[model samples]
Target chain A: MTAALMDGTAVARRSLDDTRTRVSAYRETTGRTPRLATVLVGDDPASHTYVRMKVNRCRQVGIDSLRRDLPAESTTAQVVATVDELVADESVDGILVQHPMPGHIDERAVFDAISRGKDVDGVTANAFLDMANGHEETFASCTPAGIVALLDAYDVPLSGKHVVVIGRSSILGKPAALMLLGRDATVTICHSKTRGLAQFVSEADIVVAAVGRPELIRGEWIKPGAVVIDAGYNEGNVGDVAFGPAAERARLITPVPGGVGPMTIAMLLAQTVSAAEQRES
Target chain B: MTAALMDGTAVARRSLDDTRTRVSAYRETTGRTPRLATVLVGDDPASHTYVRMKVNRCRQVGIDSLRRDLPAESTTAQVVATVDELVADESVDGILVQHPMPGHIDERAVFDAISRGKDVDGVTANAFLDMANGHEETFASCTPAGIVALLDAYDVPLSGKHVVVIGRSSILGKPAALMLLGRDATVTICHSKTRGLAQFVSEADIVVAAVGRPELIRGEWIKPGAVVIDAGYNEGNVGDVAFGPAAERARLITPVPGGVGPMTIAMLLAQTVSAAEQRES
Candidate 1:
């Protein structure tokens, strides 16, 4: 492979190490562990796995995990009330509601209910706006932050780069574009409505694929020597970009399993520790 | 002059006519005129003209105008406090603080202080998030809304189009991208940090120039037959795009003076009426 591999696992491990030191210092000073409340709605196997991964990572990083698993039939009001209770709980420093909630539940309302200070997941509108406006408070969404960290670790400076982000969903595409803009990179977000997807990607110095469509971005569409960060973890562990051809052209490329996925949990842990520090302070 | 003029004045006039009817109905039902508070800090000649134009449009549309002129020495807290009072005032339907506040003032804090319900100018972070997320909200920024209205009037469908927005300012570029995304247009925001500005523009089906830098975007940069909306009204009335060359290539182009300027005030009035109606409802 001519393209240098952007190892998300290695970066995440470093981040976890840093977070561990911070957690230790925080615990020594405050005599308490930083706590994260994870709310999982429904029994989707993937969702359960993701939550378990996060909770286990939190334990390894010396943070407390409070898990709330709701049944599939949980009402919007019940979910919101549970989130609100977490918002008010003094013991919980951060709250994260795993994605793909039951079809009936109002996800926006639930995300909005989490206190902005304790919104470690950074899914709330407030956090999105804060990130968009260059005033990130408390936390940033893990995937977006991880993408930026990956770029930084690879020494891919975003300043003056044309960053074409393929997606507009709040969690990944939107926050990723905002973070890129914050770094002074000119960002363009392409979604389903985008007429010419390949054309935009072809011109990008940095391309971020978070659209969740497997291999939607063709390898030939990538600009020569551009840095490509694939945030897409699609079915069968695939990514948005067709890696085989893209890696041949890209100067630096992130692989599916070892790229964005690991960094996400790392950022979550870092933010959780930061939240704890804020509470203790 | 082969390029068809995007007559912002004519379009704005139509919008005002619609807004007038809406205002009449709102006044008839509410027994009160739609109130828009205009807060101007310092004596910027251009800012003065913009505010006067808006106030005049308010009178023409049968909406009430609340003008608050502060000195150049006004502190950030003072401006924020004034906005806070307006937010609390039930009589005020919308509050607009003219941009480019004195160098010392923290403008973001002042804008955020305006209650989201009364944020007709759509400067608040909360209002932006609301617009981006498709949540029903009070209003959008006048210029961005005007851009949408202009495109809609011209039968420009945003869905599935590559929209290259060349700016990242809160009121213009950022909000414009968000609004376009809300419309399902794949939006890419480019600014100083973008490496290949011309390449991005050339790939765009619709190019929106909101960057304040005069003639920053060259005519050759435009894609042939693209719809060009120049929101940039910079020094000496120059636009961000090189008008002459861009006009030759563009299928539709909005001129500097007669384009986005007039439409901005029109949308402000329209949203002001909507805010009033919302209050009454």
Candidate 2:
């Protein structure tokens, strides 16, 4: 049986539309548009493209974008200083420090430098603690938050469901598991070190493949009628799930390009507006 | 087949002996005793007993104890102010605000007020994040750290093992699961909202019962040869697991009173000395 598609593109569009309205209302009330400051480091083409797309989304939602681009040779202290300035700047409602900021630079130090209130990207340790503790107002990592939004948009049940998240990165798998657990779903976190991974996947009522490996989660491992959310976007647009075969078994499945990608930016935009509204309160 | 006991009492004695050595060495080098400042809000008998026990351990290990007892009528702001003093005071090497403060006081606010470096009890959000991210130098919640130390002392291999943690409280279950996952164990976190709890428990290689309810994890649900770590401390010395029946099938098990209790105090003393050493460095 062919599975129904979880149309994240449509969901993200609706989210951004809501964000646009909020932005308009915020501007009317405070006489200032919500602004998101982004830090882009090095010359990675993909990173540049991602920042540009985010800035473009800011414009579409009636928000202002402040871009701080740094060279490949920039030190951790410089990036942290830039973030410190944004944290002190009352005009910047949200801050996003694009990840993978050169190998030599400490990414965590810079992420921690972002103010908790302005941490729209939700990369800070303080932000993570808030989310882990089930604080509804706390910002979450974009991809994980987007996955939750997508699930909620489709009215998928999370409570008491066994969710096997196939990754354990702090930004993606770990936070996703914590968020799912917070929603009362029984959550299992598996990583490269996990033994008998296929057996774990087979038992999951909801399977979330966040490992970046292309088609790492075999389609045959999916339980029939399970809800599959593939947060992976590997090279060549391939996902971690063997999409075709898994779609045949899954009750609902999210497609690669249109699935998690759009929802991520939508959450980012939504969170930026939320931060602005918070300032007024 | 009867399961072997994990012997937390013996292990804790060894650990405390080591802490005493460290405390002496730290004192010799720094010309000051390692100090643990504990804030006990209200006069709850249990909390007072716990604080007195911890202070006793501090003296046993050659560390100094500073006690701050506040009235039951204390507001959240007052509790936070008390913590703030300890955070700013250089003489206090570690700070611990006993849990379950007066219902009126915001426990989290007081926990957050402690400086991260001095949060020896590991109740702060910053410390939780550090533990979640597997930072080696960061402090961890005492009870959870004690459980890990017990497992290590018993030579229980954690890598690739399926660990089912029953509970989601910030201090115990959640951090314990994160620490196990850091050690390469595939971790599943289940709580009150979880469905089919028995099935999940039966599949685990290691079962950790941190839920305070006595005998909530039934003996029949335990997998044969599985390691059982019960962290529950309930009335009449009963634990979350049905110990007598569980020991019949388990490979290794920890007793309720003698198991997790002593190890907790040992970890607190060790962390206090560690904090003192950090100051010396």
Candidate 3:
């Protein structure tokens, strides 16, 4: 592959290192470590795994992680109450509520109850809109913000460039598109409803594939010199883009497992540290 | 013209009539008139004119208008203080802040201070995002929400349609695009930074011209049978689209003067009435 692989792992490590240093300083100054309340509902295997990774990462960065595991049958009221308690906890600097809650639970309502200042996961509607409005804030949706961080670290040009985001999800696709627009990029959001998605992708200077479907974006559809970021995590550990061929055509490409995954947790921890710092000051 | 003209005026009038009825009902139920606190910073003539239109409209609809006119040199803290008092006031059912506040004032800070329940203008970050997240709550930004209302009134199909929104302002273009995306339209947002704007406009099934540049979108660029919405207000009362040519090509188009302008005030009044109704009930 002639393309330069965008190394998300290395960048994430650097970010983690910086977060670790600041976290140490925060603990020393505040006399208490920053704590992240990780709330996972149900026994979904994937959710369990993600929560474990985030908790472990928090510990690695010298930040404390508080685990709140609820039963699969937890009601919406129970979830909201749990989040409300976390919001009231002065010791908790950040909160992450795992997604895909039980069918009976109302996800939005629970997320809405999280305190905006302590929303390190960027789940609150206020936080989401702030980022969308291009307002300066310490927190943003982890994945989208991480993707932007990757682009920034790699020095990918955003000003006036054409960015085709292949999703319209509130968390991932929508936020990412808005962030790019804030950077003055001409952004086009293509969802499943979009016609001729490939045609749009083929013309974009930067393509962000986030449709969740595994390998939905064929490599041939990528522009010859474009930068490709795959933010999808699907079955069999596959990404939205056909990475092998996409790597060949793209001037820069982010791999599935090592790319956006690590960056998300890193940013979450960093935001947690920031929230702690802001609170202490 | 062969194209069916989207009569924003008639639709807006209908909305206003409905809002008027609701305001009257709210006044009777609450034993007080539905009150809107209009906050205006500085002495800009245009801002004054717009505020006058809104206050007069509120009076016509049987709603009480409380004007809070601050000096041009008002500090951000002063503006925020005024808004907070209005937010806490039992009589104020809705809050409308005129735009283009003095350069020293932080507009976002003042807007955020308005109670979400009473945010009739929908300029608050929370309201902007609620619409973006497709959550059913209160209101949306007046202009964008008005555009959506017009589309719904005209029965313009959005499902799986290509909607190219030519602007990215948080209050206008960005929010409009997100609302369209929520409606299942594949949305693309282009701004001044977008290269070859005409190319994107030409391919769209629906084009929302919100660039604020007069006649920026030529008529020939509009796809045959497409729906065009011009949300631009430029000098001499012109719209962003070249109307004559655009109307000739598109199946539907909104006239500049009678189009988005009236609908904005209509939506604002409608939202104000809605806030009063919800508050009363």
lDDT, candidates in the order shown = 0.88, 0.92, 0.89
iRMSD, all candidates: 1.7, 0.8, 1.3
- TM-score list, all predictions: 0.90, 0.97, 0.90
Ranking by DockQ: 2, 3, 1
Assess candidate 1 and give its TM-score to the true structure: 0.90
Q: Which residue runs does candidate 1 get wrong by more than 4 Å? A: A41-45, A68-81, B40-49, B68-85, B100-106, B134-136
* Candidate 1 iRMSD in angstroms: 1.7
Q: Please compute DockQ, using alpha carbons, for every candidate against the native two-chain complex.
A: 0.66, 0.84, 0.68
Q: What is the Å distance of residue A246 in model 2 from its true position? A: 0.7
lDDT of 1 by residue, B1-281 (tens): 55798999999999999999998888787688889999999999989999999999999988899999999999999999999889888889989999989999988789889886788888776677877776666588788889999999999988888889998887788888888889988887888777778887997889999888999989998888899999998879899989999999999999998999899899888888888887777
- Candidate scoring better on lDDT of 2 and 3: 2
lDDT of 2 at B40: 93
Best by DockQ: 2
Q: Flag clash pairs in model 2.
A: none
Q: Cα RMSD (Å) per model?
A: 2.8, 1.6, 2.9
Model 1: per-residue Cα lDDT over A82-143, one tens digit each: 99999989999999999989888888789989887899988876787888888866488888
Ranking by lDDT: 2, 3, 1
lDDT of 2 by residue, B1-281 (tens): 49999999999999999999998888787789999999998889999999999999999989999999999999999888988888888889999898898888878788988887898989877788889989876699899999999999999999999999999998899999999999999999999999999999999999999999999999889999999999997899999999988999899999988998899999999999998888778
